[model samples]
Target: MNATNSQSPTIVLVHGALTDASVWHGVIRLTQAAGHHVVAPSLPLRGLASDAAYLESVPGPIVLVAHSYAGSVISHPATLDPKVKALVFIAAFQPDAGESSAELNERFPGSKLGPATTTVVPRPGGNDMYLKPEAFGEVYAGDVAPDVVSVMAAAQRPIDPAALGETLPARATWHDLPSWALVSTRDLSLPPQLLGFTARRAESHIVEVESSHAVPVSHPREVTEVVLEAVRCALS
Candidate 1:
């Protein structure tokens, strides 16, 4: 990891399935206000390997922040990149080699997400899974305003079912790098227990918050604080 210098390291934010980069907007503003370089890229919800390959293209030596499924993406090339100094997971998954996210989601099985989603959309490569518009507020963003949830649901991106079932790469970056994880206590999409399990498995410095799966959106300040902690460690 690079020592603290005159310039802050770049911070790349990765969003998970059923959402786009816009989900990071709240956190982006907080990072920007703190004078850090931030980039929240949209991860195509095609599959894990492909998405990681795409994220690997970003110039790194960065503090990588990943939410939900994007957690799997950052665990590969981006996390392994010498340029990547720290990893921050926000109510995200941390699957190991040979482990599939679908299985992980069912590992504890307390999530309301399965029932909240619909798989009626047929895409080119595979079926697209989406959180039902009516269920979005209750399942994904319980703490968010109704109006905001409305907009989020309308703009929601459907994830390829294949992505959810994709096994992780042979290797993972979190195994080597220092990591921080934020667990949303109120999250129904990715249960807090599952998040805690993954975080502990990764040996991440963890903090729990009373928020939802959309913690980055509903509690940006807290999320930014954790990201900043990883940044501090990266530069130390």
Candidate 2:
């Protein structure tokens, strides 16, 4: 699975809360054009342990790319599947062991994702959280076009409330993997400061881009570049 090998490693793009795998559409196109295989799996948005277990089941020799809440999901040590050689966090949370994504989000104060910007729908066992459509563009995709933001708003996914508070069960896998991160400087969903803090703590190769929380859609080229860099470094 190293760079010298004939087969290219897979690039698994994982989306975070309030979005689905479609969030990786642009990144997938670019990465695929560059001759790499890419897959964006739809996370169930359940609690952390279950979500990480689901991610672990994806076939590997992989460059795992995570956006937003998926950061916490991939941070689980169980996701350290032997073939997951690298981690790329795109404006995402990279929590340490015993830390929850909610905790990380509040660690720094610029996040605008509070009750005013979100809605909670009660499901049988827990609550599902969604970004309010009217606030989605401002809070999650401010840099994107209005029409595209409308479509994204309509298609946004809801995450279980438990996912936010669910603590990482063991050590962060990033501690054992080569990692990279993109800090969305203008991001309003998760504060850019929080992103910087976690990325620095993980010692990931970091890039700062002026984007909304939706960096994959707003700055796909930069996102793709980071993912490709991780692939090159991890495989080499």
* TM-score of each prediction: 0.94, 0.96
Candidate 2: what lDDT?
0.91
Q: Cα miss at 25, model 2 (Å)?
A: 0.5
List of clashing residue pairs for candidate 2: none
lDDT of 1 by residue, 30-137 (tens): 778777888887877887888887877777568889999988888764358788888999999988888877899898866887853654588666778888989889
Per residue, candidate 2 scores C-alpha lDDT tens digits across 8-30 of 67999999999999999999888
Count clashing residue pairs in model 1: 2
TM-score, model 1 to reference:
0.94
RMSD (Å) of each candidate, 1 decimal: 3.0, 2.5
lDDT score, residue 189, model 1?
Answer: 86
Q: Going through the candidates in order, what is the number of backbone clashes in each?
A: 2, 0
What global local distance difference test value does model 1 have? 0.85
